[model samples]
Target: MPRAVTLIRSTALSDVAEYAYAATAPADARLIFLAGACPLNEDGSTAAVGDYAGQAAKAVENMRTALGAAGAGLDDVISTRVLVASARQEDLVTAWKVVRNAFGDHDVPSTLLGVTVLGYADQLVEIEGVAAVLDS
Candidate 1:
């Protein structure tokens, strides 16, 4: 059976389909909380410095890897938190699109954050994910 994930959509919110406000997951589902996914390449180097879109893409790829390690996929995602440095909404929008592409039709709850700096030098975007895995 599929995991019971209910998305509450409202017309009151623009971009509601882009991300839900609330998601209800099956009680029997296994929840996975990931550490913030970084845009580090295989060699632990920042994939792209000062490039919000590239960093977001790399971070989303890492999140997908993280989900696979836990026996889940993008469809299992319940929510995501995206952080972009340099305190610009434009940066957040650019990164958000990358995240949206990664999530595809899932469209679960999400947050875009703007910050002055991140944990790593040359890092501009970070993504954290929450997922649920239900019985097959």
Candidate 2:
């Protein structure tokens, strides 16, 4: 069965269709706590060095992999936290676009944060998400 995801909207918040102010899942949903996903390459090295777009995509891909392990997909994602080093406007926008592509029109609630540094040396983006998989 497909997971039930509902996007909540309020007049106090911005009307961004790609993002939701809040999201809810079924009461019986299994919540999956994920580790921060980074932009790692196939060789286990960090990809998108100095490239926000590539890094964002890689990070999202990692999240997807983690969700798959939990028997869920992007549709099951209810919330996401995005961390970007330096927090440049262009960098944030570039990273966000890549993330949006990964989640498509799911309208997953998200928080974008700017940090001084991340766990990795050259990593510019890190994303963590909470997903719920409902039992049939």
Candidate 3:
């Protein structure tokens, strides 16, 4: 099936960023707005306490599960916002690297943020995403 999401790259924009600068989907495509995927285990405990990259990976896994339930995949994602609990740029970069690797060549438009805290205890990362998919 043809993908509904299209990642946009701008030559005018510096190529330093790991992800695309923008993305768009056709009007008829079904849009899936996912809640922030947290680094929580199935038992309600935090998956990776005090570990930025680990938490980010867990969040990405949860995000994938949510997207699958909504009939979409990572490739269908048009944009993402990654929230990391830290004042350090290195911490945010660690989380961003995990997410960027997960998306591979898809490289959806993304925003990485550093926040003071997250909802769950020991939760260091959360990922919110928007995906577009066409119904058969």
Report the Cα lDDT for residue 116, model 2: 87
TM-scores of the candidates are: 0.92, 0.92, 0.98
- 1-136: candidate 2 lDDT, tens digit per residue: 8766777878896675468889888787788988999999778788979998889988998888888988889898889998989757778878888888788778789988888898887999999889888866
Q: In model 1, which residue pairs have backbone atoms overlapping below 3 Å? A: none
Question: Between 1 and 3, whose lDDT is larger?
Answer: 3
Q: Which portions of model 2 show Cα errors greater than 4 Å?
A: none
Worst 10 residues of 3 by lDDT: 40-49
lDDT of candidates 1 onward, in order: 0.85, 0.85, 0.95
Number of clashing pairs per prediction, in order: 0, 0, 0
Best by TM-score: 3
TM-score of 2: 0.92
Q: What is the lDDT of candidate 3?
A: 0.95
RMSD of candidate 1 to the truth, in angstroms, is 1.6
Quote model 1's TM-score. 0.92
Cα RMSDs of all predictions? 1.6, 1.5, 0.6
Check candidate 3 and list the clashing pairs.
none
